[model samples]
Target: MSKVLYIKANIKKEGESRTFKVADSFIEEYKKNNPEDEIVVLDLYKENIDFLRPEDLGGIFGPKDETSKHHPILKYAYQFADADKYIIAAPMWNLSIPAILKAYIDYISVTGITFKYTEKGPVGLLKNKKAVHIVSRGGEYNNTPYEMGDRYLRTILGFFGIQEVETIAIENVDVMGVDLEEKMEDGIKRAQLIAQKF
Candidate 1:
């Protein structure tokens, strides 16, 4: 069965977040299309992920220090290594990704774990995976100067060996206000259709 790992960065559950509805819609359709696949959802808002420490950096460099073996960093590295595909859902914050998503990336982006440097240069260890990013923005920002979140996300994921990344952005969310009802409907339909294709 295909394994899909979903990482959610939205802090709010439902009413507080306008972007969460879009993520829910995409996940519903994705699950419907690929019923046989295993979907693992990680709500970053709820999870207690360890922050990067100096020891974590030491562990990545093949630390001969025996204490590093029992570090929580190894568990994170293993979780990332096990995923076959990735789905990240978040709201654009300050023209960049949410802090939770950034924290998750920092946790898994270990030197020897996700990638390594050979004489030839840096090489990604994680392989054969694709990523789908669901981004919700308050303003219309795609292909604009403000669209740094998607570019940064894609670049970081690519560095981990997940080259094929598709982003579905729901823009003008906050700007639309109560008129957002129609926009949400349209965004859900578009995201669902894309998930079906994915």
Candidate 2:
């Protein structure tokens, strides 16, 4: 069975966050379609992920000794590399991803683990993996230039050798005159269809 990593980076709780609502539907449908698949949930807020510090640099750039291999930061990289699929849930903040989500990305973007330096430049090591991004935006930004959260995420995932990436965005949630429930239900329906084929 494939291992699916569900990475939740929203600051708000599930009940209050529109992002979580869409993500929850996707995951529920995913579980139903792929019952044998293993799903690992990593909530950034509850994980209390910390930003990279000066002391953490040594373990990241230094030799992969026993101690360095067991470093907390490297643990995230290992977990990420082992996953066959990924589901990223995050909300747009300031037209970009949350800081905590970026911090988690830093932890997983380890050299010689997720990617390696080569003569042609850096090459991703993890191949044949796929990812889906689930996001909620207050306003419409999917095709606009102001979009950054999902754009950046897709770039980073590509850097990790994940070429097949899908996105499910629930946008215009807070826009005036928008039917919030209707929009959310539409997102949920799309999520379910994607899950069935995922």
Candidate 3:
């Protein structure tokens, strides 16, 4: 069966941020069609993925030392490599993703694990995977060249050998004098449609 890793990076766990709700719509549709597919939800807010220590760095570069076993950095890399597909959801912060999401990427981007260096150039180690980046932006700029959230996400996933990457963005989150109900409905509708095809 296929395995999908749903990475939820919403620092706002169950509040005004609509990124999680958007991601859930996609997952709901996907689950309807592929009931047997395993869904692994990585809630970064609730997890304990610490940074690398001096001892852990030595073990990562060389043989497994006493400190490597408990390294918070290694688990994310293993989980990232194991997934056949990925669904990442994050809200736009300052025209980009939040720091928690960036930290998650940092934890998983281990050298010689997710990617490797070759004689010709660098090559990604993980293979045959697809990724969907779901971003929530506060303003509408779909056609503009300044859409940093989706672009940066696609680029980073591509660097990890995930070529089949797609994005579903919900913009205009903070438009002037707009009805909150209508905005949410529009976002949910768009998200549901993308979920059907995703």
Find the candidate with the highest TM-score and give its number. 2
RMSD from true fold, candidate 1: 2.6
Which RMSD does model 2 reach against the true structure? 1.1
Error of 3 at 99 (Å): 0.6
Per-prediction CA RMSD (Å) = 2.6, 1.1, 2.6
Q: In model 3, where do residues sit more than 4 Å from their true spots?
A: 50-56, 63-70, 143-145
**C-alpha positional error of residue 114 in candidate 1 after TM-score superposition, expressed in Å:** 1.5
lDDT of 1 by residue, 26-137 (tens): 7899899999988888888778764677866766666434464456666556677678888888889999998878888887877767888899988888777888888888
The digit string of per-residue lDDT tens for model 2 on 52-131 reads 99999988887775565568888888889989999999989999999999999999998988999999998998789999
What is the alpha-carbon lDDT of model 3 when measured against the actual structure? 0.78
Each candidate structure's TM-score, on Cα atoms with residue i matched to residue i, is 0.88, 0.97, 0.87
Superposition error at 161 for model 3 (Å) = 1.0
Candidate 1 regions with alpha-carbon error over 4 angstroms: 63-70, 176-178
What ordering of candidates by TM-score runs from best to worst?
A: 2, 1, 3
Off by over 4 Å in 2: 65-69
Q: What is the lDDT of residue 85 in candidate 2?
A: 97
